[model samples]
Target: MEKSTHEPTADEKYEVSSSLEKGTNADNGDTRFIKSPEERKLVKKINWVFMPLVIMILFVQFIDKSTLTVSALFGIYEDTGITHDEFGWLGSLFYIGYLAIQLPNQYLLQRVPISKYLGVILMIWGVTLGCHALGRNFAELAGLRFLLGFWEGCTYPAIFLLISTLYRRSEQVIWFGTMFATNAAAICIGSIIAYGIGHMDGHLNIRAWKWAMIIFGIVTFFLGFPFYLFLADKPKSRWFRLTPEEEKIVDERTRDNAVVQNREIKRDHILEALKEPRLYCFFFCSLFLNLQNGAISTFASQIINRMGFSSLTSVILNIPYGASIVLFVAIATVLSHRFQEIGIIAIISCILPLLGAILLLVLPLGPVQLLGLYLSTTSPAYTLLQTYISSNVGGYTKKIFYTSANIVAFCLGNFVGPIMMVGHTAPRYTPAMIGFIVADFLTALMFLYVRWSQNKENNRRKHLEEKGLISPPPPNRELLDLTDKEDLSYRYRL
Candidate 1:
């Protein structure tokens, strides 16, 4: 909200931009003046070309994550001779692998071509998933699970940070929403696909679970090719075939988005991120929001079966559960983006899970309680939180560090959740629900504070500017590669 004394010069623009990507080359397209109409067409082309492939990659990723959850009902437990306790540990192991990779990923994402890296990883990831079929014991399966998590961990943040480079802050809301919505579709459709695969259990003498893993793995392996071949690596990538004018538009966008593409690690940015309250808030919000998600995803079939539904019936019921999440994500993202009341929307979304948690505690183990279980897993808060950090965080190093921390928080919540659902509790995880209630409440308060803190800063900056104590920020101040803390003219998006 504060202003800078100077508008950005060409040198400063390059300083900030050098971090995001190499600018358009002369031979590729005419990198000159662009009209508004041409810019719209380019963006629309990007939406069509980019978003669907992203959805496919993400869809496969989500389905792969839930493979363990679905395999449980298809004879994996008995086939592997694993007990319930070991099953829970497998969940944690995956996240442990995920958490381990975050720091390394921060560096790799900047240095490597993210699309190609992710592609090869998915191809490898699919092979890892299929290998689950060969596990005859807990140790083998555990190792496989860890590897799966390790590869999968490289995805979400990479996609998110890439989006920051591709679109303006305003354009990102819908894309982020679309990306989160993929999980719901994956769950709904994957469950149906799993049910169909269950019938294949005896055909090849390969149990239904093994077939499920192998089949999905093959599909995932092939999906990587498109990414390697077609996904744009930078604003000026030849893949997009932007006219020179459109490339110019992207340059303008680069300044506005303020995301640096440079690979250099800045110590000051890291220190600034460590000192900021938003970093912790992003971490804790994701951690708490995902706690219930981890538990439910791991145990959905068992919980529904205990409610007296058959395993097939339990899988079928997930259709509705997944469908509901799509709605929740849609409503939350649309409303928050439309009204610019993201914090309030986030606070409200958190309340759904809290109420759902309360219902799980008070209601008996049956259909009603099952409804509570579904309610307890609201999906919108996570999306909003992710968007907030992606839109607001500046500086390549700081954003990488910040995004890695958020992923780490996500891993921690998920890692602890399954273990917390102790076998002694059996059907109803009363204690876990109580813990979830607390986490959800804290999530709400954190969002509220983030909004208030940012708004207060906005007001402080506004007052100073009005008094002429500070000049207006340079039109392209973001091009300086400044962290949010270092940028005096920066305003936090609500």
Candidate 2:
């Protein structure tokens, strides 16, 4: 894509220059602060206070969402009299609800306390999940699924906002990896739970699938209260007991990363974000990658069952699938941290899934097909994409808008994914696997485009700086809540 050739308007130039002058004055002292032992201690303290709650909530969320897929093997469809196509609609409609609330959810994230907001929604969704136990027909189940999606929509945006607010850009990838790795852990744990629950078909005079929904929902519902009480909204929140000097250090660290903790929605940031090429690149990449996710997440167990494994054995096999996700996510995160190249890591992750798709398409239905399915669990790419959004986007509103837009695209892809695999394509699902290959390749292409665009913009900034055509950015630019396009010195991380 062609780079934008328009220069900054005079008003924009003056605003940046003034902000730079003020920041220069404020940070006039030597700004080269090394990471001291105290900073490490602060980080450790922050991790202890923050990471656990977020990880737990995210794990529960994934498990709750995965219930439909797991329960399918144990007779959700058979008991409810839902046809195969109707089952696919259940997956798609959930995303419809998810997509419907994204814009409002983004606005809420900006104006409300994220932890409190998420907690409320989590409780609501938990109730919705539990209500799935009473779903006697397709309509009832679909309604519950839609409501579940609506409430759970708050989760990713809130978590992304929290990570961006709390961690530095360099630290975000690992944290994202850690948070998403819980999905894998959830799968492992959830499978074991499902295997055990599958045997309780007649207990309580309820179907085993109903038991799974009720039990998981109850657990999810109770956990929300703790998140409400304990999760810190930001560094300046009174919940964290930091000395004045420690607060100052925290402020400086955030400024160094060029991210401001701004709450008011900025129309300019939204407009600017709408015009950025990278935004669309990221959005489309997320869309395509998650298409594969929609199919695999909803049907992996069923696929295993079709391979001659009993339903119980299929549920148990998800442990290995979950392990692969954890392993790849960890390795990809470590690579991104060491190299500081999220784009490259993301591309590599995409390729793994594409290869998996090929195996699913071409290999005979057996161990190799299963191997391909497991390999295709490229959820690490989604984690990296979240890291990219949190790290590269500047201005709170723009960040919110960008992430929300990406989620909308994510919902669309998921909505379309399962529809592509109807009853006719059951065993091999050749066409669906082919679609996965196409989506994976396109996603990788988009990632490369995003990398190129960021590098291009970075080079343009460097060239302009060398020419002395623009004033150097102030150290406190982050405080201004300027969009990356508005901040001349802002460089995109690849």
Candidate 3:
């Protein structure tokens, strides 16, 4: 039989409609609807199925991205004979593609099946990473890195969008924290794996760095199959096979979220998002934080090595760095959960890294400096930045545009970060240290603006509330896909 050619309608493609059916109350905006025993069970199943898949994808994909860092540990420089200048270019090229593609990605996000899109890109980048082992010169390596980065660009926004659509704001914080914490897991695991692979040098006449790339590539490619087969692409999913009653719960959750998932790319949403100061605040905050991240993550192994440890020993030392990431991210997550404050948590996250940069600058190189290095930067702020977007932004088009701009900041910071590793700053990397201090400080400042802006709006909305409860959403606002700006009743999350 010929394949069915029918395209699913908007109602069919977007499974969770805001307008409710039997037993599901449309007006229950702030209150959760999963009160029944069966409904609770369904919620658990949703969490169970989605969490591991998202986390594992994060773990492997991160390792794949950091393959260049890991390869540096195992003599990629000597093997390829690329100069420091070329090396910086190699690092920048990936993010260049990453930034280059996001404009198109903004549209494709609304047009495509994100799960399948992410899965396909995962496999493609896997192959690209594997091919990195074959690169003998700067040009080859640069091309492959660009391709890998170009494909990997889809990951964050797609995952961010997925989490926002799949769960309500209350549940989103956990997933966001867990998803980013997986970066630390990947670092630690990749470090351990690299430590072992480092020992395998000359086995089959293959260098350890090559082996690292090959192994990471194979694992990444295989991971795509499961994600494509199982991940829920939309709010209503074939994977969930949710019953009508269960579907109602999902719909209610989506209605409460107020960020409708549909194929339509409304021009006004994009225009509205562009005008919002908070949008620039989100992207620039990310750019500044990642400036430190891009520089530090690329050169972390080198920094440890310069502190008088062996290459393999530096690989071991990264475990502690990974530990620091987990600890800080955990604290940020818990505080956000406890206090429901985004601004303060973001500021706190930057302060650690600011201090870390200062320590790296002032103190003599040793364990203290290493401790500073670990504390100097972690991803709690970046994680919270993503959470801020998902929670606060409402229109589908605006959210994607906000997410895309954030990705651009991510790419730009990372692009310039590796360039800071120029040889003149050896022994101390003093310039990079100063760069971190300045960038992280800026990030903290921007988030302050974010919090103040949000607070002002949230406070204004309080007057609209009825007897201390949040005001009911304007009629059919959820179905209309109104932006937070358009919907006066939609409160800005802290």
Top model number, lDDT: 2
TM-scores of the candidates are 0.91, 0.92, 0.91
For residues 279-356, write the lDDT of model 1, one tens digit per residue: 899899999988888888888777777788888888888888888788889998899767655678889999888988
Q: Model 2, 211: alpha-carbon shift in Å?
A: 0.5
Once superposed on the true structure, which residue ranges of model 2 sit more than 4 Å away at CA? 1-34
Query: Once model 2 is optimally superposed onto the true structure by TM-score, how far is the C-alpha of residue 177 displaced, in angstroms?
Result: 0.9
lDDT of 2: 0.83
Model 1 lDDT, residue 170, Cα: 63
Write down the RMSD of all candidates, one decimal each.
Answer: 7.7, 8.9, 7.5
Cand. 1 Cα-lDDT: 0.82
Backbone clashes in model 3, listed as residue pairs:
353-376, 356-376
**Clashes found in each candidate (C-alpha, N, C closer than 3 A):** 11, 0, 2
Cα deviation of 58, candidate 3, in Å = 1.0
For residues 27-77, what per-residue lDDT tens digits would candidate 2 score against the true structure?
A: 111123345565667777788888899898889989998899888887898
